[model samples]
Target: MSRPALEVADVFRSHGPAWRRAHAGHVSLDQLKVMSAIERCRTAALGGHVARCADCAYTSIAYNSCRNRHCPKCQGAAAKDWLADREADLLPVPHYHVVFTPPAAVADIAYQNKAVVYDLLFKVSAETILTIAADPRHLGARIGITSVLHTWGSAMTHHPHVHMIVPGGGISLDGSKWISCRPGFFLPVRVLSRLFRRLFLEKLMAAYAAGRLNFFGDHALLADTQAFATHLAPLRRSEWVVYSKRPFGGPEAVLAYLSRYTHRVAIANSRLIAVDEQGITFKWKDYRIEGHNRHKRMTLATDEFIRRFLIHVLPKGLHRIRHYGLFAKSACADNVARARELLTVAKPEGEPTSAAVDPNKPSCPCCGGRMIIIEVFARGATPRHQPTAPTNRIRIDTS
Candidate 1:
């Protein structure tokens, strides 16, 4: 794909220093590191390599990626690599997409206490599904889940939620037969919503009692036990948001959907229309509106844009994508094999399951011959030969 005219890296490189000075001590170390990495990504500051076509001798420079999970330029390759590994695990059964979201008031608390509350969001949501599915009243089988946490809405606001991909059925409790939900349906949304609300609030309060949550600035008053209880009182009666989409058309559709979401950053370069004296302009979907009118454009001052972008930089070492139940890393292989066996379906055949070509190796643009790396360049070093044309740029549409 061709390079985007503008990028987050460009915005960071131009205004990041001033933004850092203005924020001073308010920015977290993780956010600062993200800014630095995006600014240096695919630039001479991080070095690169020279690759030449064996037949035509055409040369190109391929800069090294920062490989930061939050970098827009780095996630396409990462998602592709990850999806390749997951392809073999997909079952022939239908797959469902379910979302779990907290109320705005709860989101406020989550913003203040991200680590503790986000962890709760993942655990409670998974537990809710597992508990409900295991009930004889529901599916009565142990289901597997792959959950991905998204912390931003289309406008880059703090809207924390978990998106789970679950096979339409699961292994029976006794591990003897495959249990599948009724065709065209997964589980009842109302039951899932009520249970999720109850469990999340219960655990959130417990986290507060254990002194694992923190409040600051406008929420400083929540530090008090009575104030916290009063704040949560209204949420107790309100319903939480838990909804499931219609099952995907097939396993191929599921793979296509997962590719788009697995490694997304706050915003993609394609969504960026312009960055000029008027501020940063970008496209966003106003979900409140329906039909064609939903797509809209908005602009924000450079400082505000940078601030909003950095709001999504996750805490260091927190895993955004997680697997639970049958998909759990420890028992995934065995469990999947058993599921295929019970279903009486053989593993996908014919084509090579692995990616046909390594993304790191590119075909020659001039002669369609293999490109071989001729030299390695260290960080801050320039390559011996500059490319006659721009090298392939990885593009991911995160919007």
Candidate 2:
């Protein structure tokens, strides 16, 4: 297929050199490699083939996709897989998206202790959600939660927050009946905010005491325990920010939202609008508006763009997607089955064959017949045998 009008690759190809010159002494090689990899995601940089359809004789070229976890082109499958996995975990009731933000006091320190503070963000926010929802006075049922960590804002600013997609219902404590939370709202956002603040600060202090949090570079100021304690002092004085968006329409809506977050890094490819001799332009969502129309365009220097992009490159091996309470990965499946039974809901059993029949977008290969799978390769392994038509099939060219 033809490339998009203006892609990350086009931006990199046109302006990457200028960015390198401007930031020669500043940026690291690893960071540049990541940018290059993202830009070159599904082009000739990675080899692919031109397939010819046998039925229609349609000729088309298929380029390879990067499959890099951080590449925007590669996320469709990852999101699909994750959504499928979460499908069975859905409760009969509506689901809510919960977001919790650390105070500026903690955000500064979090900048340095990304891996640590981000970990705290997930654990604390999740505990707050499940704990508050479990109260007999509230829902009286445990809630299944999937929390994703986002450490950057539209400007690539280090604004750490947890985006939690929670099923409105959960399995009973005894795993017998399906417990459901209120439809319109779950836990009170204000209450959740305070509790989240307390849990996060308490745990953060524990990390500081145990010497688990890291402080360096721009964060060197927070290294001293006294300074760190002071940094956290204001948070105790003010309430933390734990905001819950209105419940999604249903499970499918939840998947659509989760798809946007699951494989995303700091930014998405669609965000980059242009790369000219001057700088780069991007589209950023301004949540201040009433709805999605709140999003607007933004511009940044090439070097600044690169810098912001790298800020979110998570510490390697840290898991950003986490399951909690009834949705905990280890035991969620069995629990979901029991919950479905109690709710009297017949859960979908999924499609017959899941071996992604046509993983790629439909292309007209240059052949008389439609192209179908002749050989299957598990990953990059060479195909053992390929299907071929009687007339077009070439004999084994052993000679």
Candidate 3:
């Protein structure tokens, strides 16, 4: 496939320095770092090395990647590596995709209190699902959940939601057998929605009472206790969005879904149509419009585009992807093994695992030879007669 003509890196490379200068003291250090990383990614600013094909002598200067989590240019390889690590963790059963979204009001408050509110979001959403599924009236089992938090909507708006991938079954409370949810269905959305609203609001009110949340800008008035309560009053009665899609066809489909959903940025390089002096033009989906008009193109001035993108940068070191219940990191391995054994399913033979990679070698495009590093170069240095065909290469080690 042909690479997209315009990329997020191009926009930043051309306009990022000016944006940083214009917003100097106003921008967060994290945001500024992201801009710098994107502007210099896969370029000489970060340094690189030269690789020569053994068979064809195809030599090239392969620049290093910024590997910044927030960079759109850097997530493709990360997603692939992540998927490979998770290959051994897949359960042989149906899986469901559940989404828990904060109402517009909560999202407004969450903007300023990202760390606190987002932490609560992960906690409450997972608790709600696990709690409901554990009830005798519901599925009555201990389910596994993998939730990924997304802070932006299709139009790059501040919409916060958690996307969870869950097995349609769980271990029995007695730890004797696997309990399967009915085929094609998971939990009831209405039940999940109601409980999610209560749990989130109750916890949020506690956070407010304890003074853990910070309110600023137009919401500054919320610093007052009474005002905060009044702000949450309407939301308490409103429905919080919680919905689940039909079960995935099989484990393979679940992997495919995770590959796209997890590690996704606000937008991809391929989605960008054009970048120029006027602004950026990219495809955006309008969920409210419905039908063919929903997928349409929109243009934003350079400044506004940068603002929208940075808003989703997230608090530094915050984990956007998380695991809980059976999938929780602490004991997921033992639990998964037990569940698989209960289902009388042995781990599939030769499950297409990723081989141990050699970081120093680059494969030859001409005759598929293992190309080795011939020389290393420092940051901002130019190589003499560097080959550029094949377009992409990875740099390993510095001389």
Candidate 4:
């Protein structure tokens, strides 16, 4: 049997009692229920049934998933569906993934403004790329960008960053031919950093003045105007960190990269190293790159694990994925069509096949093939198994 995942429900179901006892006064009852739901997804607690294929007579045990945005089990189909939708819009050009991180000094202020700061991170980074790329000296075209907000570092710390996947080029404002950037480079990191810092700071200041920002107990110092201004002063002087990765190997690489990032919650289930009475143990990547085998296993107490996991839960109704420039919803289809026409790039054919992917898609776990959708029977319904019609009785041996 394959290794089982250390699910949110696992932590909640097995360890939730300890967490609730520890945080008796702080956690609401509804919060506990949400935790339980995420933990028990795809298990018997929530219930499941068997599904049969009409064409092939193959049956599968289909367990209902939580469908919570934070559930790792649900993200696979979400990512696949999302990628399917974006496939129609892929530009026939190279694409790059860029990341922007706030410095420690700024991150202190950012901790208090997770909602606001994270939103600014998306806007500033996407806007920074578009503004710079559209310059005459640069690519000078409007680019398509899809960005995701990530708030946790490898160690489950509050390190926030934005990951952007961008098609290598864009169309000029006048809707002329597709413009391509230098093969390896997308935009200058130094330039993007400076612009991003300025744009974000300006917007932060606006949010502060509008009183959309919040300051808690220790961070109340930021509530004062002078202190807030002083806090931003050093960031103004210091160089911001806006880093860009080199262009993807090819279009397939771009899809593979998206398959990994999009719809991914804080951690994948496979990363969990162990779960026992001591607590939950999991492997995490060390980005500092001290060595190739840098993944470390760490265990935590039940309460500590719950605290760490729930800490990353975002405020309700906030969007972590955003589109900008040519990728913006208002004009993406038109712009993508025009750009494709100008570049004379042929559309990729048929559905994409992931080497191995989400359980929901049900492609051959052996060699991947279209697990054709044959039927949809209702709940508690079963098809009558009929006697096989013999080929010998019906057929003449033409061969």
lDDT of 3 at 70: 87
| Candidate 4, poorest ten consecutive residues by summed lDDT | 390-399
Candidate 4: misplaced stretches above 4 Å?
1-5, 28-34, 52-60, 348-399
At residue 310, candidate 3 shows an lDDT of 92
Q: What is the lDDT for 363 in model 2?
A: 36
The most accurate candidate by TM-score is: 1
What's the TM for model 1?
A: 0.96
Go through the candidates in order and give each one's C-alpha lDDT: 0.90, 0.72, 0.86, 0.75
Residue 362 miss distance in model 3 (angstroms): 4.9
Judged by whole-model lDDT over C-alpha atoms, candidate 3 comes out at 0.86
lDDT of 1 by residue, 1-399 (tens): 667889999999999999999999999999999999999998878888888889988887777889999999999899988998898899998999999999999999999888888999999999999999998899999999999999999989999999999999999889989999999899999999999999999999899999999888999999999999999999989888898999998889999999998899889988999999989999999999999999999999999999999999998878999999999999998999999999998876744634467777878876889989898899999777766654564222111
Q: State in Å the error of residue 336, model 2.
A: 0.4
- For residues 167-219, what per-residue lDDT tens digits would candidate 2 score against the true structure? 77666666667777666777788888878888888898899999888777877
List ranges where model 2 is wrong by over 4 Å: 17-33, 289-293, 352-357, 361-369, 372-399
Question: What is model 3's C-alpha RMSD?
Answer: 3.1
lDDT of 4 by residue, 131-160 (tens): 999997988898899998888877677788
Please write out the lDDT profile of model 3 over residues 18-58, one tens digit for every residue.
88889889899888888888888888888888888888887
Question: Quick one: RMSD of model 1?
Answer: 2.7
